[model samples]
Target: MASSSFHAPTLVSILVLLLGNSRAQLTPDFYEDSCPDLLNIVQAQVEIAVQNEKRMGASLLRLFFHDCFVNGCDGSILLDDTPTLIGEKNAAPNANSVRGFEVIDVIKAAVEEACPGVVSCADILAITAKDSVVQLGGPDWEVKLGRRDAMTASQAAANSSIPPPTSNLDQLISKYAAQGLSAQDMVALSGAHTIGQARCTTFRNHIYQETNIDSFFANTRKPNCPGTPGQGDNNLAPLDIQTPTLFDNSYFVNLVAMKGLLHSDQELFNGGSTDAIVQNYSQNPDAFIQDFITAMIKMGDINPLTGSDGEIRTNCRLVN
Candidate 1:
């Protein structure tokens, strides 16, 4: 019987065959194709969408948060048959769908309609994240493409890896670092919370406990959190400071006043290990933007398959 697996030539062999030098390694362009170019085209469309409706920028940011937070940008959450798929909502029953998936779906559908089976959903995610930051008035970061889809989705892994809305500064730092992001990256990425909303459940612990939380903010949140657990998450928790819907560095400004709603946000200003980085970002908007870009680049580089570990998936939904 014949074997049924498909295998591309090894990188070493390919280099030797193509250039007579096995020592030569692949560059980012080696994997470039219609998929990444098509991603650029879709990014343009998202820009237009954000331009028309500013809320779309927050939606895009939410998408990045949900998609990556769930499964490290594997595109598994986008699957119609995901185990945790929440009807048409695209999130866990009480969670939001991160909104931008639909926008990305539109782009994917257009790509498929124009040229069937060309782009990968993983690439779509990477592109959308980079573009969404730009849409939100952040720096435009460069993304290296060719991320293949994962064969499985992990609700456990998602829950395990993602920093909860109530995470302290140290916890947040460790989690991002596991994904190959730095402490600076953690602060910059946390800036994303500046425009998102969390449910009552996500931050309820911080409010009701009265021990880990500041008294004033806890008192304010008590009515919404009910002083109990498992009671809320559907409640809205916006990430932005000035415009809850718009993207700006006001999140940093909010930090200066101790107005951060999420524990993760407050922890940054809690005089802990990461406070200096937070203060630095808060004091300088330009530095925040610069670090945000660098952090995004670092975040995108996390544990991705390259050279040989994974395949270029035809359908963004599953691994080949």
Candidate 2:
């Protein structure tokens, strides 16, 4: 028998070609035969979780976004830190902010029992996000599946890639554009804020120092998010004051009224390129829904590891 091994350069070239060909191989019906009930199982679990705590829906949605934005929806964000890996959970953008990991664990367990290793954690995150939005009264979209779990996580990538609450309009646009998202996508996706709450520390600067915010709204939020550090830092406030638990156009409405809880939220409506897009969404709920669905589907298509490129992890937090 001949022992076979390629030179370093030849191996690198082969890997790159494989990865390049693996992109965009996902489809809506990827699991039709392998795991026919995958969507239903995920939906049922997400529904129960959201019913127990409405905030769980928002947390899941944010988790999906954070996961997708960094390293392209490959379940890298779900990995727990190991001796060699620095997981994204403890990164500056995600530390003490992202939640709903246990819900994902529950769903993963149910999925494994039903179909063993057929489904991918990346697909689970995407589908759970869509189901969560629907359960919370938001629009529904068909999620493209077939993504595979990442073998590693990157804390440095998460810290730099995930947009902060303090981003300006240009910074936000550039950040989204880097992920192949448009300004319209940015505005439409920001509507996810309608259902979630932001921590006091996340929005403290906006409530205390920003001039674009409504004085009354700022004053109201000020008490909950004291100017002093470490006081009320973890206190929660609705991103959309009108309907915090409901997924509606109230987030755009809040933006129109200068009541967006975070500086980045308000930046969309602050006399910038995204202003008209925000106004359109604020007034037309149908338009917002359509655009949001389009944007979400596009977002979910980000750099997925398809074909034989990556594995379907039996445990989302640990690669198999």
The candidate that wins on TM-score is 2
* Tens digit of per-residue lDDT, candidate 2, span 9-77: 678899988887656578899899999999999999999999999999999999999999998999999
Per-residue lDDT tens digits of candidate 1, residues 1-320?
A: 12323333465567667663322332345335554457557777888878777667767655555556554655655555445442223334214534665587677777676556655576667777777777766677557665655566655565677676667677888888788778878888888766656667766766665354447756766676665565654665555536775556788877766767777778887778877877887788888888877776666655554344444455554345
Backbone clash pairs for candidate 2 read none
Tell me the TM-score of each prediction against the true structure. 0.76, 0.93
lDDT of 2 at 244: 92
> Model 2, residue 304: displacement in angstroms?
0.1
Clash number for model 1?
Answer: 13
- Looking at model 2, residue 8 earns an lDDT score of 69
Q: RMSD in angstroms, all models?
A: 6.4, 4.7
lDDT of candidate 2 vs native? 0.92
